[model samples]
Target: MAYWLMKSEPYEYSWSQLVADGRNVWTGVRNYQAANNLRAMQVGDRAFFYHSNEGREIVGVMEIAKTAYPDPTDETARFVAVEVTPLMAAVTPVTLAAVKADPRLVDFSLVRQSRLSVAPVRDGEWAMLCEMAGISA
Candidate 1:
């Protein structure tokens, strides 16, 4: 299965919110590239739940529960969304600073495209981050 990373501002929709809700459609992506990433996702794909802005850290893991569908927020139907279920919370949130400092993660999408909200994650990178968070990859 493909691995990915999805970012949400803590104040807007945190990892805790996702855990509480169990599952929900991940929507509101306007960027073409991020939209493409969403469309590329499939049910059962795993993703890192990242808290952007001030919290710049990966707090949990999520698995895609539903494949891409027309986004409800887009009247033009230009975007797509996929439902995700919380898989597990990290023992210690993996911070962005830590990610940037790691040589093994220099090629990571999170570092290369810092502004992208959704991006692909290589298996090696995923394993490294999970290791940093003290969780089994």
Candidate 2:
């Protein structure tokens, strides 16, 4: 399955919120490229639930529960949203600092496209990050 990194500001919606809610619709993506990333996702695919802005760390894992669908929150209907369910919390959150310091992750989309809220994650990168977070890939 495809892997992805989905970012949300801690104040807006944190990993703890997802765990409490059980699941949520990942929406409000207005960027074309990020929309495309959402469109490319499928049920069962995994994603890193990253806390951007304040925390700047991957706090947990989530899995797509539904494929792309017209986002209910998008009035323009130009974007799509995927249903996601919390999978597991990181034993140790992988901070952006750690990610940046790792030379092997130089090409990681999260580093290259810092402004992108949703980004693709290569299989190897996913495994490495999971390992660093003390979780199974």
Q: Which candidate number has the best lDDT?
A: 2
TM-score, cand. 1: 0.98
Error of 2 at 40 (Å): 0.4
TM-score of each: 0.98, 0.98
- Residue lDDT tens for model 1, 1-137: 99999999889899999999999989898899999999999889999999999799999999999999999999998899899999999999999999999999999999999999999999999899999888888
* lDDT of model 2, residue 117: 94
Q: Assess candidate 2 and give its TM-score to the true structure.
A: 0.98
Native-to-model Cα distance after best TM-score fit, residue 90 in candidate 1, in Å: 0.6
Model 2 bad stretches (over 4 Å): none
**C-alpha positional error of residue 85 in candidate 1 after TM-score superposition, expressed in Å:** 0.3
Worst 10 residues of 2 by lDDT: 23-32
Model 1 clashing residue pairs (backbone): none
Assess candidate 1 and give its lDDT: 0.94
Compose the digit string of candidate 2's lDDT tens values, residues 1-137. 99999999999999999999999999888999999999999889999999999999999999999999999999998899999999999999999999999999999999999999999999999999999999999
